[model samples]
Target: MSVLSVFVPVLAASPAAVLVQATEPPAATPVQAPSTKTDKATDETPVIVVTARKSSVTNKIDRRVYDVAARPDAAFSSANDVLARIPSVTVDPRGRIALRGNSQVKVLVDGVEARPGVLNNLQASDIDHIEVMTNPSAQFSSDGSGGIINLVLKKKRKDGLNGIWSVRGDDDGRYSANANVSYKTGRWTANASVGVNRELTVTRTDGRQHWQTTSGLETTTGAGRSTTSPRSSYESASIAYDLSPKDRLQLSGNHYRPRALSKDAGTVLITDLSGVLDDHAESTVNPDRGEGGEITAHYTHTGAIKDEHFDLDITYGSSQSQESSTHRLSHTVPSQADQAYTYLNNGRDSSLTIKGDYERPFGTSRLTAGFQAEQNGSDARSRSENIAAIVPGEADIDTAFSYSRQNLAGYVTWQTPLGRWVVMPGLRIEADTWDAGAVKRNDLRFLPSLNMNRDLSDTTKLVASYSHRTQRPDVFQLNPRRIYWSRLYAYEGNPNLVSQDTDSYEIGYEFADKGFSSNGSLYYRVNKNPQTDTRRVTADQVVIQTVVNADQSRAAGLELTAKGKLMKKLDYSLNLNLFDSEVAGMVGGETLRRQNVTYSGNAIIDYKPRPKDWIQLTLSGEGRGVALQGYKTGYYRLDMTYRHKLTAKWTASVRAFDLLNTSKQTDIFVTPEGDSRTVSRKERPAIMIGIARSFGNTGQ
Candidate 1:
């Protein structure tokens, strides 16, 4: 009897009958006679097979990887949009990114340091995945005290030609287009891409300040509206060649240009305990532009030994920016003379990096080592003039500044397995030199890291890690020249600022089954001599903002993530983070301390009604955040996208951003002598529609 026939009868029979039949022997069947002559031919049938899709998120012992290619909205999303959807990552209206309430985080592209504003110019479609390492190994640079984020670019290894073209536009006067093409033949591969984006934004701001004066209490209120239009374009090209079966070489270059124009108008009211002192009207206009470019060359060699390789890379980059502004202020209540101001500023910066790495395996152990050398230089010039002679000695001022730095680092790590546990230990040493006009300094530091992983079963694991990292002061923080914002406000950098150091530790548990995965982690971090911005009033009653080193700070947090399929046609991903933070520092000879508990989370739900249609919804938000002398209110955003495949080579999508129109930020500062509050709001809800076409093989 066939296996199916025997099991079917056993499953359908009663328990008593099945038990009796199982103990008895069956009778044999009679065989038929052999068939004659020729038998009729039969037609063949085709067979089909289905496989499960890969998960959008993967948790490793040391890091978390997010697959950008697996998301249906990647084709129409920007780098900022993608990052906002990730756990522990937050992006503000100004495009500033923070990780776990810390702004001192480093970002890299394909294992290399990227230039500032690079993320704003990148499209999500150009990236294959993103890696977040809260406690990085010593092999990586210790530039960021919080953590590191790496963007891995897509690679085309299959032969022949491939290309993609797309165009998108929104109802709020924004538009973008991108084109990419790649070709491979023999041992050579080449790729090129070009893109452009244009945006028009409007914003409104309101502020109120109160202070205790010698005579009585003084108050100031202001309201302002501004509009900005920015245009950006980027182009990149790369080529790779294989010299032999074990050797390869690659060369790549990219360039970007950005330009913007802005206008602002506002009204200010000043009052004492008695009555209104003055009513002032002000207006300003600004124009800004910048361009940057970089080139890189890389080489690799493979050894005969398993998992043995050597790699080398060299990169050089340069950038320049210029801005000019004009402002006018008038006292409407007193009918005083009008005051006018004009300012011009320009800056240029360049950087060079060289790196080499080697890895080898010995039996069940692996060793890795790397070295890096970096050099950076910058120059800035500014000119300010008060046409109305309102500020006396500050009428006409000219300033010039230059800064440079050099760094050399080396690191080594060894990984070994014992029973069901794996451990890796690493150390790095760095020597740095800084020069800024009259200021000079030299320092040496040693950093260490340890990571461990234990396998509990086929589908579960435990991991723990510890790392020591540092954050150096940037050029803007080291410059001593004053940059004026208005007659009543200015900003300056500290020449004696020092680097910040941090120690971080984390423990996590992860489990993965056929169609589900979850990860939870607990972490703590301590920072020494952290840098923070402070505000003070000068003898002339002008507000000055500057950076200073704080005594210390501490943070502890728990992070959780889960992703799986709810049914055959629905899937979802969720992330939640809860944290507590404490900061203590001295400002203007006053000791200040602040503490708070906060939380952040995001959720993504995807629904597939048909084979060629998809709908996705994403919700993300954060709780109140604490600052050195102030606090910032939290905000939430909701987004949705619908995508449909029109044909094998064409696709269309529509996306809505900030659907609830609740994206706003408020900041409050309290001090012994005064208090202030400010609110800022950007654009409202927006809808965008896009179309994309694919040509040639994508190698899927």
Candidate 2:
């Protein structure tokens, strides 16, 4: 646990010659008061930081950190609220987070890859600090080709006891609550947390386009709305105890319960069609519920060597979901005779990973090596039932399958600094063997990286790096089973999909000062057998999407970012990234041409006109550059907040989104078939306000 920051609650940036990362040689911050409760304990925090590429003890880091402590009744809803506003980062609309605009990134929690094979679901309040490592060393995981983001959590203490609780309700009629606490005594510390959440989210898209069918006949477009909702509930609990200063054990589990409920109904009519109304209506109720859990334990020891350490960890996890569905006519409730159809599915999997690493520091250079032995297995069983409407007969089928994969890996990395130039180089090798009943497969990959950084001055710097990485297909992506998101859209996994390998080269420069900071980077990422499906497709029956691999593909982009204090009461931040992607074998033959996307970077300003009054205005927007030229659309949203301390312990707050009532465009999906057509769409605009108060003297 370490920190390097001094906050004054920004109205405008301050002209302070403070470093985002402090070097160890400098004087450290003064110690603060100790904890007065159990479960929470006091620990050492590194106040001095070493910045640079490989970062010498005298160099400074180029990233900034934000403090996001939890409050009562607070809920973290999305990645958008957590990663944004931090220095050197942005997460695009598709849950794609990146430094600049690279999706090949690594996300970690507490320094460990957070269930490497799962999705990102960390809450904001659960986060202590978001470490945005724009340029990492060889000691880091070399997977996709983007920077690393590590979300650190709060530590437990040994003493009395104190914890926080929160609850929230979303627009889709979802509610959730969470609580965490810890306790400690003399030589022991223990902590526990549990949470439950249920929410419904709906997405709709509308677009107009022109298309040519397989016969080469062209037609103009129509627009409509298709809605999709993921109504689900999740619950989890975890506990951990420290055996010693260097050893700890922890266990955790979670379950996801979702109402497999969705319906699609829309009308698509040509702008000039005479009595031509192409309409499609369908509803699917997937018996929605899922179960998942994990158990893991680890031990670590710091050696007598000045900077040597060793860690050993083992983990086991599994999850499954079952769905039952019967297609129904939209707006129709069968009376006399209705046949019921049930579809059942289940996903069961487990993993055991034994990983170890050793690190040592010498002079201005550091060296580290690690190894991992992992085994993953899954067992699945399923059944289907279909009954006729009238004199019905039950039709049933049962099936079973099993799969396993074993992986062995070893890596070595070196980091060093000479004068103001920093350098890091490392290599990793992995061997994997897969077994599925009568079939067996084996794959091997080697990853390498070389990075260099130079401090042009105390306020300016230049950086360049090159890497060769590999991405093995995810297990879910390789499954052949059909994944039903809704009746209109279905996903079929391809077990025979090939792995995608990539080599990335990047160069960038930055300028940092008390009043202003600007940074820009250019990168090119080339891939072999990239995994991306047709962005959009059309059909008369159902939108069927087959998960397939593409030939070689190329993605290149440039990002420009600027931020600083505009005045004593105003701050500004802006970031823009333009990227191009080319795919072969798409739409048959010729390389698919598409415009690059310019992702959004937001800016916010807070004004404390008086000691009891404050106001915050934020501006946010995103524009996707597509191949269809004018297919990109964007919006400017304004959110304002006013807060006042009515009394010493009482406060009130109000915030609004789209305050001006300006219409905003969210997304668009269009496809055309010569004989007939289908369309999917969605949009939104809203405003919100809330108030609260406190009776205790919480830390200010």
Candidate 3:
């Protein structure tokens, strides 16, 4: 009994211990054979015990899986909230995701690439598990260079009806509601879910920039504050049917609608070498509205041969958005310089993908092959006008831009086991065509990967992998239109921007001991033609920010995560990532270099004094980081949550977010000619209370 108590905590720490791994469903039979039993058994009763997986964390050869669907103290309301708990992953104040200190991560829903903002609309309750693939295999797409995060949705697997309803509210005028229902009967299953939310946020930005020109130096200082109110709703439905004992078909659709309004006011001061200041006061109001929808279908067939399979997947998605901003400025130095401007922009995007794969067993080895064809297109139109002209070159401007891309890819992989090790090797071939206005590009690329896993003992394992991937230039990065945000700020896309290619390598170790589980990895990445955001100052001291292809860069990092029970009533988990990065680039015939060493980590501790009550505290933060031409400062946050069960079907919870309200960012840019510094801060401290209920079949 003493040994069992110590061992139990180790096996249960990983989220994989909570959710059963996916497996093929048992073949249905019209009738069952009678069971054989002794006559004496009929006079006695039978006893049975059932066990279910609990919320924990675990790792595979290529990824780490986190299962939080059943954790009452997880405090996971949205997809973003779930991501915060993952190791080496961070969600910024603006909801942007960064993995391993890089922002090029890709997010997918059930192995499919979803549209932007899709994750924000999903309820965490609907997610079965999250897989963080630091080094993906050939079966995955090669679109992103950083990494991949996959969200797996829950499905109805039982032969009954089940549903959940939850509502939440906070002191900052934010409220949300979600409902999910599913039913399974015979060989068919159906599910539907809906979520609605309204949120209000306040933010502030204050910064100063100093430019060193040939003559001397020029400085620009500004500070601004804004309030945003956004409302969004989402709906999804899915149906699955078993065509036969070895075949199945599934279909699903999702729709999301969101609208937001923002108002901001600020003051800017520009000073020359003589210390003479030109002061300006500015205010703006912006309104944005958008809607997106996606439809997907999947078909699977299992051959008579064991471990043989074929599958087909198809998807179509579309979105449309419109945004407009009105700005007013007042100048103190030159009263006649005061002016007002209005800008409007509208955009539409659509994409289609068709993929199919086949897998078969060959003796003691397995081989899989797949092909994918995809097309994406986008169009945007912008109009900028001077409401009250107080300067030259302020005439009305109207422009339109459009871009399209077609991609075809094929990949093959073979996996075989030898002794106590497994080896996999894969290759992918891709052909791409891109078109924007009168510009066109065509490229053929080959990507290769190798992965190996070895078991050292019953309680330890090792894995090593390498892969080559690419990040294609975005449509907006290829557009050549000049978009003016204000009189002193404007940007123009570069038609010469090219795709960034990356080669990544990782070595990992997994270990387990009494009441504890841990995993660690060391990774290195080399990038070519790295795309970067560059800022150029004009003669009038106007900063133009644009995307450009840099020379080269490289990054090396180490990541570690661990979870276990400290006591019978206390559980704890920790995740950490440390990395060193360097970038080299040439601008205007001058060589530039920037290097940095940064780190980030997250820790959580939970205590349960009673069977029905629990409390948890989470600490997460980041360290200083370097960019292409500059560096950024980081901040930390503390959060807490408490939960109590009111009844068998009802649960109550409370949460405090950003308890210290110290989440902020500061950045510094360096150049041979001059340097700039910018600081942005936001205080987000709020408390919330929520309730959840589950009815129908209680067993999962």
> What are the lDDT scores of the predictions, listed in order?
0.82, 0.55, 0.81
Evaluation by TM-score, superior candidate among 1 and 2: 1
**Which order, best to worst by TM-score?**
1, 3, 2
Across residues 1-700, which tens digit of lDDT does each residue of candidate 2 receive? 2333443222123343334543233356455444444432223222322331211111223233444443211232333455654544554433356565455577776555665223333555456556665555444555544567777665544365644444544464555555555556555555555555543424454434344545444433433343444544444555566667665666655554444455444333222223322332444565555666556666667777777888776766666666566554332223234234455777677777777888888877878899888888887665655523211242354666678988888888777896778877878788888765445778887777777789889888888877776666666666655443333345655677766777778788878765677778887878787765543334423344565567676767876777667777665667666677655544423344344545655666657677777776666555553322123354445556566656654555554545664333443433333222232222443333333332222221
Model 1 backbone overlap count: 0
lDDT of 2: 0.55
lDDT of 1 by residue, 1-700 (tens): 1011121122222343332122113334443333343533211211222223445667765678888865666667788788887777877666667777677888888778879646677778778899988889998899988888898887645578987788889878788898888899999999888999888778898988887777678888888898888988999999999999888899999899989899988888878978887688888888999999889998989999978999898999999999988888988876788888888889999999999999999898889899999999999998887733645455566888899999999999988997788988999999999998789989799999998899889889999999998889999999887766666568889989988999999999988887788888899999999998877765444567789999998899998888889998998888888999988999878999999999878888889999899998888878888878898988888889899988887889998877898778898877666877889887577788999887897511
Candidate 3 residue lDDT tens string, 241-325: 9999899999999899989999988988888877656788888899999999999998989999999999898999999999999
RMSD of each: 7.7, 8.3, 5.5
Models 1 onward score TM values of 0.91, 0.75, 0.91
How well does candidate 3 match the true structure in TM-score terms?
0.91
- The candidate that wins on lDDT is 1
TM-score of 1: 0.91
Model 1 clashing residue pairs (backbone):
none
